[model samples]
Target: MFTPVRRRGTEILDDPNADAALSLRSLRDIALANRFFGGKRAVVREVATLLRRHSGGNEPVSLLDIGTGLGDIPAAAARMAGRRGLVMRTIGLERAPMLAAAAATRCTDALAADAMHLPFADRSIDIITISQVLHHFEDAEASQLLQECTRVARMGVVVGDLRRSWLAVAGLWSSSYLLGFHPVSRHDGMLSVLRGYTEPELRSLIERATGCHAGVTHRLGFRITAVWSPRYRRA
Candidate 1:
């Protein structure tokens, strides 16, 4: 049996020429997986913590989620902040126009844009969160994406991604089948996990990108999270 290598492979949804309806279904399936698995909880947990620590001021907090898929995760995080009396302005950014349209209803704002060159000015948003979007790129592009996140995020950035391991890949593949995920999504997810980062690799990548240490931790269901502030500098 051939072991899956860490090299990146293109997911069907990543292709610009992918069928519209298929892509939408694939996105929906991915969102469903996040709900059942620990992906949603991991991101909301980190974003909620960041919001609490920085949301003391009366001003509304701003949050931008790159590759916001269906926009459900940030919507949930925003509601959580509302419960604490902090108004959260959620921005959903997606490269796909169709996905952006669906996300707009769930967020304070939504736009179709590339994450590599964010439309917002530097350090403009209060918080930035990216989930399961990095693995689509190579190390250089991934590092650059992190720089963009740190550049735009004023308060902090939270990253939620998969942990690369054959065991994890197998678990998700089986779970996806039992959950009746779109066939394209199951294949795409397998590639995503193969492209995922280990704990130390993700930490080192963030440190290299931001020139500051990050808090990287493992969550349930092969998820890993990294949180860091752009203001922090290494002594």
Candidate 2:
């Protein structure tokens, strides 16, 4: 049994060429974890907030979900948007082909694309989101990824990820055990928390990398969200 350590490193799920079966199992476990541990709720909240703030709750918006896993978050947000009478056209991007194929089953549009080199025009996307993906990269790579996200997003960018802390480690470990998560899922989940960032750390990196000031929040369930956009409203 592997214990969650404070050491910073990459997880098996971070690899583009990770075993397909294991990756799918790991991704499903992640979706389950997000369902119970505030990952989906956190990103949904930000998406709704941005919609209300920037669109006055009625305008149609195009969303690009980066690192989308099974397109869960985008699908959830789309349902929320529909209820609010807002038209949200969503496209999901994944680096792993297997993951992209899985996402296609849930999302109308799913493509395999690298985060650092997005194949989109500047300011072409209305809203961009990257959920639980940043911790896989170093500070420099994370910064570069954010820069690409910011460049393509016209309205704003939302980043929802784990917060590095002992409580987070313990919480995920216990939750995974209780849920009977696969061994690979358990190992990678622990590593994710260990590799996650604090609010200030993410905020500083976003600002330094993109010259865009981001609002970093410590949410419930040991989640950290960093949002930034020229059109965002501060409250």
The numbered model that scores best in lDDT is: 1
Q: How far off is residue 41 in model 1, in Å? A: 0.5
What global local distance difference test value does model 2 have?
Answer: 0.85
- Backbone N/Cα/C clashes per model: 0, 0
> Which lDDT tens digits does candidate 1 get at residues 102-158?
889889999998899999898899999999998888888988999999999999999
Q: For each candidate, give its TM-score against the true structure.
A: 0.95, 0.92
Candidate 2 lDDT, 6-64, residue by residue in tens: 46676776766788898888888989988998999999999888887654456578899
> Candidate 2, which ten residues in sequence have the lowest lDDT sum?
1-10
